[model samples]
Target: MLFKTLRWSFLFTIIGLAIAFLYDGVTGVTVTAILIVLEVSLSFDNAVVNAKVLNRMSEFWVKIFLTVGILIAVFGMRLLFPLVVVFVTAGLSPIEAWDLALEKGNPDTPGTYGYILNDAHPLIAAFGGMFLLMIFLDFVFDEDKEHHWLGPVERALSKAAAFPGVSVLVALVWLFVFSRIFSEESADMLLAGVFGIILYLAVNGLGDFFDGGLEDELDDEGERRASTGEVVKATGKAAFSLFLYLELLDASFSFDGVIGAFAITSDPIIIALGLGVGAFYVRSITIYLVHQGTLSEYVFLEHGAHWAIGALALLLFVSIGPHIPEVVTGLVGVAFILLALWSSINYNKKHRGEDHVVHV
Candidate 1:
């Protein structure tokens, strides 16, 4: 079962290594291996969330996610995205940015590719932090959510959903507080963060709007019945919109990992090849979790994943003011995942034979 599930991962890993070897012999191969591991460690929770969303999408869309989506992820975000960032931020041409990215020096020192990438940390953090914050908010505020790993806190957050736009408001307030707390030089980051929040709202709002009338029925009480919607049967335009959402979500998670990769190596090709392998594994893991019904059995796992996302969002903002080790970001996510797994085990032990469990 595992081999059948992860065969694609194996193929990609081999391809990535071969590409790495071609890039610079042993040094490229070693860096690529390290980067692949780094991406996986940093993105385990990302796999869980991707699984949750991908399970809802149709098979065609899932295939597209693996194919075209992988192209976008590998080349667009991992490689081209940084150049775009440098171009926009430093007013350099694409070629100049690429040259800058290849400049070798200590990552901590200025005038190197790593330095330029790391220098944009605040901008990257602001965008990622806001986008991820919205996702975390949406999950915690989902009124239909029954399982809770952090019971009291999650339950309270859910109640806030009663107020429309509370999530946006809270996210904005967080951005506000962060801006004030950070140095005056970082005040501009709030604008970037707000734009991130806006994009989340726009994208998710479009998704909800597109979902209109899909699963609504009147209850005998003359009120709209609560929708126990099954997996989406989306097609055409609906599928496209969902595709956009998934890609944006992937982009939000990728921001930190891509930036952090510079700390490993500044070669764009190596970064793309390395992170690409890890991304392939993430997709495979997502498929495995969905088909095996891991989320259904281990209810608290989703809870933990969202909590980890929330932590990551906050850490991104906090890192704008203080340097945070990439290891810290990766380990925090792992901790949340493990804790959620443990909680799920305990929940199963407590409720061994419930006649029913919530599927969605």
Candidate 2:
């Protein structure tokens, strides 16, 4: 099983690199590798979170996510989304956007597309701020309460094994608000907001819908020896859900990375390479977390991740005002997660006894 897993990982890596090479030769290969690493590193927390969600999904959806989902992630979001942003917001024609992206002979500075993105700092900041703020509020508000207004919706849908459609409503609200605020000149801002929300909802909803039922099936605890079966089931659910959550979480996390990468380079191939490389490391880290059961053993890691998410949301929301730096926003999240990890380790040491190291 381990060999098979390793082989598949290698295959995927080769394929990813091949795709990059086809797009831009040696430069593409090198850049894509970097992106994969950056995305993976920046998104380690995301994978842990995704595991929690994935354990709940059926095998079919999991396969779909790995296949079709990757395409959307690599191409739709990383490659196409930026172009769409430029066309809509910057008033650049599609051809112009394409030209800017493909412009050659400029070695020292970013291309026309990069310049456009730089000029659109306010817009990027808006997205980053809102994304960060959402993370912060989510942590602070503890919106997952069982008896809140959305509780009934959650429970009713829980039985049906679907996520509460609250994400759609949230997206709509985001569209309306941004549309009203940024629509005076063009509806691009509204369109962008809607697109972002829809992306969030689709990824989030599918994860919840698939994972909810598996968790439901694991509730019975009466028939098992050493209770090992029960523990495995419970842990499996937790791990899977965690993974799914992390995937969605990483998508959310990418809002800034995507924007930030534009600052460095505008070549779609280069951007994809750098981000994709990061994503690879993130996947590895998440697998490590799952295999090691870091969250389960540590206890406080989940709290930390949630807190970090909440902080990210707040930061994203604040970007609307255009004063915040993306680096600071990212650092805040990193600090929160690190602190949580430390606390969890300490807690485990105290509770599990000094001689015992908690393993997943």
Candidate 3:
């Protein structure tokens, strides 16, 4: 199962490494390896959340995710998105932005591609941070959700979820606080943050609207048993809505890593190769989890991933003024996932032993 799922990822890793080595010898190879590790670590939670969404998608859309979705993630986000950012933020033309990126100049220097992109970090962070915060808030604030990993804290939050637009209110308050604190870029920050919130709400609403009647068709275990052709049509529309949400989610998560890559190296080629390969593995993992029913089995894993996302959101807001170490970001996420895995295993053990008991 593992080999079947990861075959493409393995193939891409070899190709990415070869490209890196041919581009800049052993140094390129080393940087590429570091980037793969960095991307995979930072995005493990992304995979978890992706699997949850992907679980609902049909096989056809799943293939689309592995193929067309990957193209968007690699070239679009890793490569072209940075150029576009430089184009817009640095007020450069398309050719100029492309030329600046190819120059591979030092990030510390003014007017370099890296420096411009880094300078644009506040906007990127604000936008991505708020989007991610909304996801975390939605998951925890789901009043109908039965599972609670954090116990009292989660329950408390769920109780508050009955209020309409509570998540939006909290997210707005968060943005306001951070905007005031980073008053120098307060206007830009608030604008981008509000846009992020709106984008999340818009996509989420579309998904919900398309999926409105889906719950009625599903059985107790949430499997669709209906035979109506209309159900099939609705399913496809819902899947497409979900596909868009997933793509935007991927974009939000990739924003930080793309900007952060400049700190390690100014070469966009290497960044694309490395992070692209890592993205393949994340997709592979998401597929593996969906196929194996890992989330259903592990139970709390999704909860942990959402919590990590919450932490990352806060970190993004904090990073507007402070320099946060990548190690700190990666470790916090890993810690939550590990703790959740342990708790899940224990829950399974206790439940498994009870399954064999006979009732009087």
RMSD of each candidate relative to the true structure: 4.1, 8.2, 3.9
Model 3 residue pairs with clashes: none
- Model 2, position 306, has a per-residue lDDT of 58
Clashing residue pairs in all predictions, respectively, total 0, 71, 0
Cα lDDT listed for each candidate: 0.83, 0.56, 0.89
- Each candidate structure's TM-score, on Cα atoms with residue i matched to residue i, is 0.92, 0.63, 0.93
Positional deviation of 168 in candidate 1, in angstroms?
Answer: 1.2
How much is 63 displaced in model 3, in angstroms? 0.4
TM-score of 3: 0.93
lDDT of 3 by residue, 7-95 (tens): 99999999999999999999999999999988888889999999999988878999988999999999999889999999999889999
Tell me the spans in candidate 3 whose CA falls farther than 4 Å from its real position: 213-234, 353-360
Top-lDDT structure, candidate number: 3
- Model 1, 132-167: lDDT tens digits are 999998899888786666777777878888999888
Best by TM-score: 3
Clashes of 2: 71
